[model samples]
Target: MTAAGYITDVDYIPGFYPQLAPVAMRHVAALNGVVPPRIADGFRYLELGCGLGRSLTTLAAANPQGTFVGVDVNPEHTAATQRDITAGGLANTRVITSDFASLPADLGEFEFITLHGVWSWVAPEVREQILAAAQRHLAPGGLLLVSYNSMPGWAHLQPIRGIIRQYAVLRQGDSAQRVREALAYLLFIRERHAKYFEDNPRAAAYVDGIVKQDVRYIAHEYLNEHWTSFYFAEVAGMFSRAGLSFVGSLPVHTNFWDLCVRPEFQELFRTTTDRLITEAHKDFCANTAFRWDLYARAPRAMKSFEERVREADDIEFRVTRAGVTLPHQTNLDVVTSTVQGPLYQALLDMMSTGSRPLSAIVADPRVAGTPPADVSRAVDAGVALGLFEISARHVDTATGEPRGPYAMPNDFNRAVIASDALSGRAVAVASQLTGTGHTLGDLDAGILNELVERGEDGLAPRVGARLTAAGRSLERDGKPIKDQTEQGVIMAQACEAFCRTSLRQFLQLGIVSPG
Candidate 1:
């Protein structure tokens, strides 16, 4: 391997994107709402470390109107991405191989930027260069998406990292080869020190699981020359240094102070007058895989009201009580009350059914006969009412489109369900209650019921659905949600999460028309 030991080869990972644009666009579009100013004209997107251009490809395909540029230092990834762009016949996207400091002058400014998997793996200098480039290229009101390894969440990996680094240094050249050798040696050490596993089953299980992981992820993640994890405060500070401001998370549900962890914990951390504690808790929850930050060129600080509004805008849709439907109208007094057509009237007719998704309700005879065009029109009208939400159908980069409208990747699902506190219990109950892997509605009911029983009022079905989807995505992305990879366990957990969030979101917005 070269001294720097970057993974320079393409892994032929055609379907490796963490999230797909369909779902993302739904959320982001809903976040943008009707505000044309917050949504940039001639919006340009820039991606740092565009591996094989998978993400950019998805983004370009989904947002045909937008332009995207991706840059990476790895020639293999760049070449493969270029090939994909050509084959896909994408005119809106371009990819180049260059260091952050050597960006092409004609690239122009971007209204949205994403650097996933590059920030924490590079030297501090490169990180700064990337931030500098982001600040320079980003348009005012533009969004920056940065994902990285994070502290406290990744604290357990530090010891493993130290061991890998130590072993890697002993081997000459061939970083992948060195990683393999080191892993073997570590296994030998673990076997000899079986007593360690005896006392700490969880840690031992983690080690065993790591041993079985794809060697590429193992080699690059653990043996890399520069792998740094950050705290929320540090990340915030870095972006601030680069003249960017903290907006929220890409998974909009994640950034909300109301969604993460236990309510007590969140209340303590998020509302704390103490900034450090709040940041520490954020680091603990996110493990720093995804970040959604917003920046403007003029540097006038966003007002608290403006930030809150923007945060709400950036979110796909919030799950809220049925009574609170059309909040932007009743509370904020934003959307017009004028009805558009019979389809719109039909949608409102279904809302009395207590938060059933428009997709589900449309299958019923009352709406099934509606033309696709009319259905879409009705859906958009509800979007105007703040009654019906438009969530993107989940897409997989591995496959052109999901065979179905949704994917319930169970293995990944279980890991996420297992990781949470209340969600875990809700998942367990929902699985038992449904006698199968949980669906969006099942877990949504389970969690809201639990929360209500625990005296938390104002429970909404859409809230649970939104959270569930976020949890499931994390699982399917190979982030390991459950402790064990037992049959169906992971899948159940992930679906449970997806169900909760999706249902919550549908319910929160009037997206669900009642039968």
Candidate 2:
């Protein structure tokens, strides 16, 4: 570790990121008509800079068939991860404490390698080592997912980062304290109407948002000694040296041209036949701040239109929100649009029942006349809008059996819910269906924890007691219930909603069983 001890600091918070899940990565690849590596059976998955290893541990628990390895420089992070793995009784995951530059040569190849929030935060030499690892260990057709702050979008915020870092270095305090001081300084300057803030008005909003973010996150993001933002073409060129070709973005929306770029720029984008140039132009148009890019060692041949539609048809989707109303609005930070049409409404209606495969949905009489490609596009749009979640077909390929409500309780979810209860801090819950973690709020975690301890027969009273202990009471029509009878009624209603919506979602995620 260096004298500053910054590189090996363990001050970072543990959190789960669903974007790094194999299901999510594979889904994005499939959206581009590329078959991702087989993760259903034995597959190697590695995450570099896996801080606290929360994401990898959750993935390992959800995906017992795959081997998961997380490497980080901080011994504290790796040790904490090992503790989590042991607690969870996970046999398929391990964490190693080693810097990227010194990664063991015999670590072997991986079907999927991810570097989340690390690419733009490390030194050039470290980045070179990461690429070398990818070059040596990324299996052919394997996906390399990397997320970083990108240029054009981050251009305005660069100066703020610089100012914060400079101020932090001169301040006499620990990382968190320095971060607070730095943010206060920035706010002081902004309030005083500094010339920098005057010229970059949007940057002020960025700083305001940053101030409200987790202090630890702000410290890691701004207090880092080395941070660089790149354009899509620039990062693409760097990966090209490692024989990796850009596949697609993890966010499915970016794959669709209409969703990413404006109408006027579409013609200009069409004129440019180069993929890199088109992406660069799109970045400028959308002001892309962060990117979750997927790269493959070798590009898969594009599937024919019929083949693509056939493959797409097998993927499953479920509505994420309840009681969704149309003129459905989708917000891509850069742009927001209302999706209003009979096709969208019909698709939403279909998903309201439960998880449905795209094939069955397209076969519905309401959309029977719609072409498969058009249906695929509509589904893609819906997913991008957060109206639906797409699960890769391979997630259920091994069973090859019709999936109904969960029949067997998921031990992983049970352990996770129990751990959350003991820790009194709820972050996320493991989702077996999607092979990822779903965000869990405190109340949901409390309710689920109570459900785990007391079965449905004893659920309501215990849950209500738990809520009452937490100073949360059942609400009816947005008003808190004080009367005992009304409280009972409202609690019953809340429990029903939990069973219908939250528990149903857990079932879909294979977190719990109908039994």
Candidate 3:
């Protein structure tokens, strides 16, 4: 092992994952009627193994009231993160280059601690240190978010992982080259009609998919010296040692038993009763390969069913997509369900003007007779389907006034939008409303940047000129338009769509103001 006692030569890729956002955790907690850690403002957040620190820096930009710190053993990663922080003018964030095992105790406590795509890839000693840090640095009632590769689903892929790791060790090259060699070795074995590959068709298919994936991701996932996938029960046990209790999964839909497991296993899950055992059984039922879990120093008691319904009533919902239709289908793991008809349509209609509290949605004339339970289920279904989003910002239960985190544009999003004017490659924008990031296409980002700078009148001309300068011409019916006049016409149409659809989403997400 290197002096750091962990693999450092092969750095993890820089990627932004919205699942790591504190708002996502709070949203899930709120859905369950449990009080989440107070992260609305003035919260200290820490991220272990924060590669490139994209999520942390973006979050810091959005929540200037909060303090953010990221720790990574790689100096190169830390340097890149520092550069990003400086460029974004984020004063509330910092990155440290140090192994988890040697993290300074004097760094102070944090209310929100996160480690994404790290636990299953690091050595056991490193994991021990991480848990130790959680026990020591996590303040009372703090939340710990950890994501890892989980089992039963990974059972079919474990042997493939072993083969790749073994082959990578013998190859001499950079991490990407080693990943290519390992994938080639697997392909060679498959070509020979190896008994292992013949016996496991799914494993062969997984190997085929891995061959096509980015080598950087492959190297971090498979080329690591130590990697282990855990069962849900096993992970729960490990966290228990650190004085943390598993609250629930980040995706609110995962907490709904009926939505995750097959019908046949639902009865078994109900009878199991124990949360840990039920989670494990659900994993087996769904063949779940990955999990984003939330743990707390002490789990708060959930409100009674009626009280939970009342709490849910005060929360607001917004349709993320414009002109969303019904007959929505939600597929989580192996479980799939379809939601249709007037109930969802009415809810969508109510949100068309702007975000409305669920109380208003439940009381709407069109769906006034619908049962509260049905409304809740449909809302959850819509959220899982990505047609609707539940805002982290809460409303005062009595007065119906906005409470908790209020939506506002932030420096990080402005920086991202400004950067898009030159690079035009960013695919996400930070959403202050949700305390998370939202995805947008390169064209949409370019148009938003131009609109921010030049306003509505200059939007189409700026976008068309940018596209022309980039050697990109608009396409229609699978054919590129090369004529200057035709290109301008298409660009105008594209900008109009952006104004109608993408711009509305930006307004809802708090990435930009309506004006």
Off by over 4 Å in 1: 1-5, 9-41, 194-201, 269-277, 284-515
Candidate 3, 42-73: lDDT as tens digits: 78999998987888887776566789999988
What is the C-alpha lDDT profile of model 2 across 1-515, one tens digit per residue? 32123444426777888889887887787777786776655789999999988899888877788999999888888898888888788888989888887777789999999999898888887888889999999999899999999988899889999999999889986888888899899999999999999998999877878987878888888777878899999899999999998888957788777888878778966677687987888898998999999998885754664665454444578776768889978877666778888998898888775667766777788888888778877887788778888664323211222233334265556666666642434567676566778877655776667765656675667777777776767666767778977777766776667766676666656666555
Q: For model 2, which pairs clash?
A: none
Alpha carbon lDDT of each predicted model: 0.52, 0.78, 0.75
lDDT of 1 by residue, 1-515 (tens): 12144555425233334332323432333332312123223457788888766667655654556687988887877888887677556787899888888899888887667777777777777887888898789876666667777766566556667777789779876666777888887777677776655665555557887887666667767766788877778887888888875544444434334344444556675347454466467656545433443333433333343443453232222122243323234211211244345555555555443334334445556676786445643454444444554332221111121122222222223232333333432231111111112223334434433342332232333333344665642244646444333314543554456445553443322222121
**Where does candidate 3 have its weakest 10-residue lDDT segment?**
395-404
Q: Please report the candidate that would top lDDT against the real structure.
A: 2
lDDT of 1: 0.52
In TM-score terms, candidate 1 sits at 0.57
Model 2 TM-score, all chains together: 0.86
In candidate 2 the C-alpha lDDT for residue 80 amounts to 84
Candidates arranged by TM-score, highest first: 2, 3, 1
In model 2, the runs with Cα more than 4 Å from the true position are 1-6, 309-314, 322-327, 340-346, 349-352, 356-369, 393-408, 421-426, 455-500
